[model samples]
Target: MNRWLARLLDTRVPALPLALFRIGFSVVMIIEIEQMYRFRRLLFDPMPYVIESTIPSGPLLLIWLAAVLFLLAGYRTRLAAVVHYVMAVIVLGFGALPHGEDWQGDSLILTLSLLLLFMPSDRVLSVERLMERRRRAREKVKDPGPVDVRLIHTVFLYLTIGLMYLDSAFFKLSSPMYLSGLGVWAPSTLPINAYHNVSWLMSQEWLVRPLGYALLAFESLFLFLYPVRRLRLPLLAVGALFHLGVMFVFPIPVISLLVLALYLGLVPAGAYERFTRLWRARAVSLTVYYDRLCPLCRQTVAVLDALDLRGAVAWKPLQDHAAEEPQLAAIPEEELLHDIYAVDRQGRIHKGVDTYAAVLRTSGWLAPLGWLLGVWPVHPVAQRIYGAVAEKRAREGGCRDGVCSLARPGAPAAEPAPHRGPGRLARPAAGVLLTAWLLSFVLIVPAGPLLRTYVTGDGALANRLENTAEYYKSRVYPWTGWTSHGVFMDEHFVNYRVQTMLVFEREGREPLRLPTIRPDGYTGSYNSGRLWELWTFETVKPELPLDQVERNMSRFVTYWAVRNGIPLEEGRILILQRPMDVTLDRFRRDRLADNLSQPWKEVGAITGSPGQLKVSFTGEPGNQSGLYGPRS
Candidate 1:
């Protein structure tokens, strides 16, 4: 047992998987932030209450963006992680409360950021690692070999993710909707979830039923299969496919990509290394020849060598290896000295800008940049830029008489060195924290159900446990309930589409419905799905209190008018419910078009100007005064 514990706790593992996870996580976050920034006025500014006290939303977003960028670059990573986490909590967590903008994906992001605090994710493939390598070289320190992180950190990450899926699966299994195989089909039918018109596909019982069961199985068994060494890679591949499908089918791109990013942490060290090795073996080979005696040439080569992680480029100094290489011997010595050259495996020579582009193409993650530089319009501009730089270097007499002060191209200074692993206390601390976290998953998270089953006496102990469980469920794990309860497991699926219309009550003209909320086509439907949800579900729903809905509608109308340049002085906002009975029978009969052509029913309306808007419900008899209030 002691040996097993030691192996689990102290063993060193490759940090590549964690590094990849960090990069992927950062990329998804960058995209999410950009999206939020694009819609900041709608998302942050129009909230009924103040979002932040000290920092305004705009500046806060900018600061959060800078922190995320630093985290992405892996510079001052620990500090960046902390700053980003605090900013996320402030902006996304609490700030969303007033506007009912809290998303379950934000919870996952918060959890991941917390996990990042404990991870040594910057140990490899980071700017910090590169800087440390340079520092060691400058100080003449010996290389400490390949970078590796503690096995405990990797275990912590995997267990946290596993428990999340397992927790979700536990609740899903209990849900009648999932057991009846209506889990996937129900959500696909809703306009709020589906990106495209997938009602026809959802109507196919043969396809959806199996997909529903498969999703349940994947979520339920992922925790078990992911830990098995041999099954890890295949499980991750399956997960990738699952998330990719979700991305195409739904508008929840942020959540889908975030979940996919987490899968990177599950990749085994050996498997990742093997995959990279295979990629490098199959990649096109190229040899780059540069002037070693020239300071500028050597500097440029050093940077490229660092980026060439797969060693696809053979960097040979023309001053030293030209005589030995037949390919170099074919080219004029004067031409070789004047400009950089790349000889591919086919023995075709590329010069100047093309040579740089060729080198970039061989480097992993830099291939897109290489393609951009070599493409039409860009290639010509790049050639001119390269020529100007090359001309200046030649005029200055690069390395006069074979004398240069810079280190050689492939010197010890340029080679990567292993970074320091986590501190001695880090392992024990992480182990304790992770153990407690897993215990919360098993004990605290489901405490309510467990206590209710076993402790039926209703004593003091039972009461305390019940209170604690309720607190955890309501406060600590509020966002998690959405994941646990099968998504779209509502008692009744929506049979009507909620449409918000901006009506202008002009004297000479009929009530004009502005195109603000009306989606144009499939793309518009996909983009404005969130807007519909905000106005329909959160703002103007009949279930909401009349006063609250009125306030929300006022803000909504004001923002809508300002954003779309619509005059709201003599206008009223209408919340119409359009019948959309997308049943399996209708789908089979090819009568889905009948549902779309149905006339709109005005369920609610907000009349008068922006600030003085009065909300009134015209739906069912009792809905006029709202469900929570007495009828007037």
Candidate 2:
């Protein structure tokens, strides 16, 4: 029994699986973080976009990363493993029931990896245990051979994971929505839609159903096929392929990858050792420059340098070299030390914002953030802001010493009352007002689909008849609940456009008269062929049309139409069609074509059924002249 137990159990290989799991989990988390940053969105703004939880993902990421570092160091292994499990569970739980989505395949794997980490396998390869062993050896204590208990734990963990796969498969098969392709699962389908890759996937019928079924089978029957030791690796390889396929289709979270790593087992021990030997052999020196006098500056530099793994930066005391370096010497000794300073590999000197960028680029941690900072408007604006602060610091003189001296009368005080200027306040105030207006629009607008209008056929004949009331009845509004009347028409021959004005009041109430619009507020106005008035959506105050103003007006009308569910085709008809071409159907052509030779007396009832309207339309044109006819 002892020999059998020895053959079945081994402690030396435990870290391999854990390492794989750790690496995979880190990758997934990083990818998710990057994706969020790329979209410039928080968790709640986009679909499958959930409201960010109270526990911010950023802090949680730091916690998980700290656990990884602890595990790598092999320090307090048992405690680290336990903490790792707890953290993984909390993150995975949120992912599994992500506020907007269901258990994405990625979430399932993450949850499994957390479960696997709880196994006693750590007793074999833990750094804590190794340290303890070394301490015992130094004391000349006899070495214990192996821990069988840890082997047992590994076996149990593996079995538990295999069982989880089975459970996932079972649930997937049982899900009615999944079976019907209803896309209600949230994560899977929603991501597909977001990427705009749904059409391609859906078009491939052979791939879709089979891919779904394969995922189902892989999870459901994993253990049944690979329960024993020999088949485990191969089965897991297949499982890895399944996960890889999923990753290709959808950007999954890091936790899923980490869990998959566990299933794949760890790297060969020899390979790990070889890699570590090379890594250890390489020398990395990091130099960080911090002001020795300022406690705050010193602390920040210390934290940053500590986080730097590559040792690319070397910290130098700014005051020590202030007299030596030309750039440093150019700045007063105190001023140079007051602001942050860092140098890169190329012997280039950087200060303040530039230095921060250099350090971030060196760390390879802030590439995305740096890129955003480098973008126009952001870059220039940030540069100006940083410059102002630096100038202010220079004027104040040695804020680094934690003492302040007020600006002197002759020192050209840094933009006295900086906050009071139009340069600062005007832009921000305008931004605030614009933001408020947009927010109001978003909030007040109905969530329902926008109004749509469609126009077909050449518009030439419709425009010529002008003031006839029947001309306005044909436009479509998706949000229109009741009858609509078209009142205003502004014709432009140069642009070949006809502007139709439709005022929608409550269904029962008549629209207010044009005269009631108040002349004080209405400065720029034009007559509408004795029938109505034409007011450009923009500036009743402008009283003139500049190219830029017209362009802006065009944009406003387009955006309004789109948000209100007005179709592009309809908007174009209203904006670009000639006045004569704007009619639904010409009165003189359709009605009087065959009867042109005869006197144009009252028409006889010629019965051809007009189409039944899907949505209600009140066929009333403005009291003025216009024509609204067939949609085409």
Candidate 3:
């Protein structure tokens, strides 16, 4: 047992896993940043996100992303980590990002980014490594590569997955729906889940309830399985399934995909090397067929080629191969047009995510990742996910309608251009920083109070961490509560849409539901952010007393009237809370199901007097209006 423990803790790992994970994390960060920016740069979107600082959120976010880019290139690793952690803590604490549901979705990413600092993430396939290599080559010295640490960073990463599951399981257990084994179907049924096609399965209570129980057990089981070496692969494999299921049927792709990516880390060091040595996949050649017409497809191909260290994957555009490849003609054009496929030297064919899985199989350090995904239940689910994404494939490119320069070289790519110069710390300095962090984190993360704060979002350690982290933010702009990553999808598998409408006492000017942006004839606008943003503050802001909800409503309505040029000396503003069953089958094209004004409750009211308005809000025990009346 001691020998096994030693092996488990001290196994020498290649730099590839960390590098690949870093690159993937960076890409996700950039995508998330771009998506948020496109949506007016609020942390989340269209609602209930956190970010309204004295400093405009856009510049602040750009600065945050610069740190991410630095992290991506593995430069100034310590500084980037500190910067990210500080921002994350500020957002989590003061930004009111939580808004009283559970937590925001990106919180997982923020937490992982914090833990990432302690790992040897920059040692391989990074700009830092590349610089060291070049420097070594110039000086006629052997490149020794990265050093393995005393504690297993990979194990710590594994435990985080367990922690996430444990916390989620705790919440699930607390919910009657989950305890009754209906929770699995409930989240999938939510209109907000975005997995519309498969939502039909909600009726299969047999399938869903059991799946719910299975998920609960699955999540809870891994905690015990952490120390069992023999079951590690199976544990990770099962985890892949649980997360893949969530990925397919939920809108929480950021966390689901992040977890899936990290699952690759659970494979023991040299597992892929052993697999490759056992099977001469090095001798294997792969021809990847992609719809070059799709920009996403082309970009995916470029990334795959860049990561394929074995010179094994051959990229062919389906448009170019239609005539030459007999296999292309054999498949239906409709099927071939949308989904990407791969043909191996053995004449075996793989499609969609399976094709990508095969490419990863040949790609150094990621072969086991391919193996895990290609394994039975997980593979099937992955295919479904791939199909789902494929269903929404955009044919457009950088130049629009695939009419752009995508020059492809005939040979395998060599030593990709290092996305250089994020930071310039030498290996020794970086290692020292990493070691110090790991030592501290190993002690801190598992401490009773720290764990409590992390899981519950409030505790002594949480308060201290929150306060200490504030010191790290840019002093010029106070981030006390302006930036945060709330818990991931604390929406409780329910959709809450808050609507405010003005009812004028005057003639012919009927009440109008507040449009998110400027209305056609309106000179005044109330929406600087999403509806949930306004609602989040009104319903949950602690400083705003319960009696002031009506006043808050009055403020918003008054502002809206002024902006829209509506003559409103005395118009009542009603803050309506529309709570919909996320798990119910509301068959409508709009995410709101085109059902508005129905099933609405007046959570808060603003009475417009001749001179000024008085605002008030009420909440019942079961409701989450963020306003709780005096306890009975």
Candidate 4:
């Protein structure tokens, strides 16, 4: 067993840090993604579409987090590496090229991701591979390749990342932006008007020249130095020095930390392991005192104990011997026996309300509970009630042998009952409430971020045409025995005519039921096949005498299609305008004759008042008019 453990660590040592870094960085990236969603940028902006179009990322973000937690739990090394690497790239791409507007955090994660992709950290203690080996050995399957894949991947990943810095340095040699004292290391906090600062440094030809040359030289040399194992540590050490200098001058916190971590990775794995062991050894647990008598109280205590965190909570009944501990010794035996109290890991005693939050924090399940505990008025109310109960218990005659004695001399007294309250089932209720919360988050929340696009006015009309064309292509055009409706144009609307147009023409007379028509037809004639139109009232011209009639026709045509170019007569052509004169028609024949004698032209021939007429004819003569709007 010792030999096996040694062999596993040896194989996994190189990849272990890389995995740890990847897991850490990925968690931050997931948080950023959530922030983007909160800001609406995830749904409305570019990053989400670039990746989520292929994978619905809202749910995928949760999956990625779960996978990383599994990795931290030491389960499924190879699978975790693969899953982590893929997500890291989706995250990486967004930080890399044109979209990489701010590259600090993402660049580091990308580098770590590439390293983990090729590492063999899973061979050591990964739960998935270990379980598989056990199950497979029983069937006699051969074990696969060298266990040092993780190391090899890490070496390559580091080399590539070092190359990025080298290229950046090299490019600065020629970039005016870098040379004008605007180089990454330039101080953003330089005193205003200081001649030695970046603003003036750009003008110092001799100084800038050597600085540029040095940057290129150091960067280019770094690429060659990083590959040699003996020199690798020195190279990383020098890189850390450079980053530290930049951190002092420039304001790039993310970049500086990333470089520091990379340098630290060069330290021997034994050192990191030792450090973690010491940290874990010094860790302490919190102690909670809960009642064990009431059924609800006992059950709650059991759950708290189950999540006891290795010793986070210690239960003591009203009669337990632990009540005699030094911390409780300060209070009189009667006072101590009256109410429950908890001593935190720091040895500070919390008697009532504050104890609940401490227990939750210690239990490591406060994420769902925090909001409830955090609510404004409710939190204070809960705390007050808890305090009241604790004080009331204290006021009762000191509980003795699970029974109460008198507090006031000669007062009628009853035995003190066990402490119970509305929140007694907080533990069990948490499980159910947490499940419900998670379900809502998993379904409705993700669905809410799904992308949708909407357009109004002419765009909607155009989209309708496009949809109609698609329907016609896929379903309607194939089996139908109907003729194609060729396109036509008219004064008030454009039309497509099939077997429906001829119904609109009644020789020399307006069609039946034509005068009562309204836009959309629902309030008027539902079955009537009439032309529909709509006008922009917002753009109306007041002097266009017939603006109201034109506006009405616009809406009418939106609901109806008016077709033209099909000849009404075999002989002549003409122009006609029939005014709906519910009020002005009272002038009678004198009005009719005056309207007829007036010359007519194509309606759109010349721009005039909306009611003015202009028409052009290429055929024999004719005249036409049709009724519109309600008749008196």
Candidate 5:
């Protein structure tokens, strides 16, 4: 029992997966932050429905941006992780309250950032690692060749992911739409959610029904099987393809990207190494020779080494190899010391700024940078800058004494020592903390469902269980709300589509529609989809009173009018429901040409000025307005 516990808690795996995860996570976050910044006004501005002020200040977003950038560079990684996580909770969690833009993807990002705070992601593939390596080289510390992370770190990450899948699968299994094999098809009809029209493909029962079942099976089995070492790689591959499909088909790019980032954590260290080795083998190779005795040159080379992720560039000291290497024999030692040189596979030497470009070209991601530097207009300027820097370094660098000693290659001084992890007491404490965390996670994730399922009758025990379930639902579920993975998992999703239309009745002009319906779709540019989400929540749920919905719609229209410089002294905000049954019936009968010819039914309408609008409901649950045809 002790042996098994030790293996589970103390065994170390390669740190590459965590490092890669940090990179992907940071990149996705930066993209998400950019989008938030773009829509800051709409997201942070006050709204009629939001009773309390949840506005996140503009400077907070800038701070969040800085934190993510620092996290990406791996400088003070733990501190950056903390800052980013806090900022996400404030800016993404609370700030999105007014616009109702907060999503499960945001929660997932928060969870990942929180996990990153405890991870040693800076141990490799970071600016911190480069600095540490250089410091160790200077101090003559024995090199610890590669970094390793505790197995428990990875275990928790995978555990969280598996629980997410399991939670979603359980909900999907209980959903009648999924059972009927119309889970994917139902959501495809929602214009607000879809990016491209795939109704024809989704309507094909033979293709979509099996796909629905396969998706359900995949999610259901993932929790149990993904942790198996032999099955992990295959599952990860399928997961990637699945996310890619989601990204292409849906407008929720942020969600798909975050999920894909999480997939990086499941990659095995050995597999990552093997794939990188294969990539490096196929890449072009170059050898860079620099002045070793010159501190500036050595520092520059160290930075390049950090950037050389593909391992395509080999660095050698010109002082040590000038005499032995035939390629360098032709160039004078004075010229070699004056500027850096790179020899390509064809034995052609590139000098000064050109050498930098050649070396950069061998790097996978930096190749575009190399091409840019070598372009017609930029090349001359780069050459001039390189020449001036090289001249200054050659004159006053550390080599001025002409007798500076250099450490031999492969010596202790040339490599960094392995990182010493937590102390003896701390390690055991970490183990205990991790165990407790896993236990709590396992217990809390399904607490609501379990409580609701077993506890029954109106006794004290049942009341307690009901309270516990409600507590979990209102509090804990927000953080772990991956249960709604089956998009449009209800019958109403197939029955009708929700749309909000804005009309501006100007004094001297005809009424203008805020989003003019085009042949392609709704063409409003400013946060139109977010508004659709908001209106859908209001109309479908019917929890909010008609007056509150009207007030909110009035405020939204006024905000849009102000932004677009439109005079909206009087107008009507119409929340319409378009029946989908007729279209689905047509689609089923192979009459695809006029599938979208169904007329809209007004569910509710708010008329008058923004301040004194009157609200009324027509096609509500009890009221009949042809919303569901003869069934109503």
Candidate 6:
């Protein structure tokens, strides 16, 4: 077991996975911060009516922004990760007090960034790496790539994501609403959905049922299949498509995009490597060295062979007499294990992202894409993305005969996986850390509809290990009820079912209106068209007391009046709510064609009886109105 474990860690791969992930995650953190800043008045208002926060929003935001900048620059990165997570806890945990904000995306970012803290993310184009290069002492004892450290990071990453999604699937299976697909159908048909214009396509039962089942499968099955190499890319591709559909079809905010960004790490670097080699039908200007035994590469070779109309490139499998190839002889064998090497016409060597792009340029249609990838600014990111894919491909390629064992191109193939050194992560202390992580993983073990069917329940260890770890999150964690519960619910409330159109008027002048809620402050009035979140938070809340919705709206107008200098107590605020019977049927029949038709006719205030319904606010604060959580 000891030897087997060592070999597993010794498997050759690149540092690019963690390094590239660090870059993408930092960008996401920046965007979250920017969005919050853009809608400060709406999101961060400190009035008693707003959700109470544990810490000062200003300082927490400043600290978050500072940490994000350092993290993006890869300066003191581990420190940044620590700071980043600390802020997440403060904001998402405590700041989301009373009732939680949608915290799934924030939780994911926090967890992933926390994993980076344990890995060497500062090894790439980082300030720390550059500083190390300047020190003569550091140059003497160079560190071998920390493949073990990389594996540890990967373990933690999968462990976190797997637990979350698997539990989601479990909760989904437990929900009856999800079984019939009404959970998804309800939300997609709502006005809030950005793609409502085309969302009617899912009205087909065949499409909706399969889609519901697909989400359950994607979230649950991916956890098990993620570690398999041949199946890895395909799974990630499907996952990306799933998230893309979610992004447009629902109003789930930025979580889907964050998941898509993380999936960037799953794309193989050599995706274009050997495949483009066979496209050459003319004189060969470039020679590509690849493993002919690799199933993935062989398929690519066949496709390229079929596609090759002009012989412009040569794809050569690394034969026993690899050294006999003139230019290949000079290249080191160990590096070849991690990358597919390419030799140009003038004996110029190309590998990694550059090699794939160079060879791909031969195809007329793909030439533009290749050129774009090779450009200086774009190539850096492209290189890392390719490295992420290639490293995984090479790791899973497996040793063929003894040929893959050779450390140099000319040397005889004699080994399996290469073990270069006693890397830092292989130390006893590192072993202890890994052991602790694995032990804790048990508490969050997998068991859901997918797992229970085959692995547990009536299967092997049914009683010994719980089939699912739902109790801890679904019940134990208070906030998680809000944060995580909606995975497979058969029905999501259509927020637009009761839309409120607020038209405010001063004593003498016309009720002022603008395109939408201006970020600056309240104009005279706004329609219910684009104020989905704001209006829904305040008025569409049915669970609240009839007076509770009024209090919430009044607080908003009070704040708005403060910002825009309006005497709110003397003004009239007209409220109109769209009923479900009228709106839902109209939506099904018209499919957004009659979107401009107001639901006010069905539920709006009586047009002629202005004085019948007169409600007044004293501008005095009482109990804060609860919007996100009416039950609380």
By the TM-score metric, which is better: model 3 or model 4?
A: 3
Evaluated with TM-score, which candidate comes out highest?
5
TM-scores of all predicted structures: 0.79, 0.34, 0.52, 0.34, 0.82, 0.59
* TM-score, ranked from best to worst: 5, 1, 6, 3, 2, 4
lDDT of 2 by residue, 582-617 (tens): 221111222111211222111111111111101222
Evaluated at residue 508, the lDDT of candidate 5 is: 63
- lDDT values, one for every candidate: 0.65, 0.39, 0.55, 0.40, 0.64, 0.54
Best by lDDT: 1
Lowest lDDT block of 10, candidate 5: 584-593
Q: What is the lDDT of candidate 1?
A: 0.65
**Residue 43 CA displacement from its true place in model 3, Å:** 6.6
Residue by residue across 436-525, what tens digits does model 3's lDDT show? Answer: 534433333332233443464666756666454343322311221112222223343343333333433454566666543223211112
**lDDT score, residue 93, model 4?**
47
Candidate 5 lDDT over residue span 1-632, tens digit each: 44655675567888888888898999999887776666565456654222223555567788999999999999988899999878876664544445554355755776687678778888888889888767654444543668888786787678667767776776676666676665665555555445666666765768877777777888889979886889999998888887787776665667778878878877998898787777674644888898776656766777777788888898998878767667888787777887788888888988898899987888878999899889988999999888767665532234553433343233335443444454466457656755654554544444333333444434676566545544654553334332223334453344444434455554666766655233444323432334444545543323345444555566666556666765444545565544334232122422222234555555666565434556666747522333322221
Sort every candidate by lDDT, greatest first: 1, 5, 3, 6, 4, 2
lDDT of 1 by residue, 119-168 (tens): 88998888888776555544344546577777876776676667767766
Write down the RMSD of candidate 4 (Cα, Å). 26.1
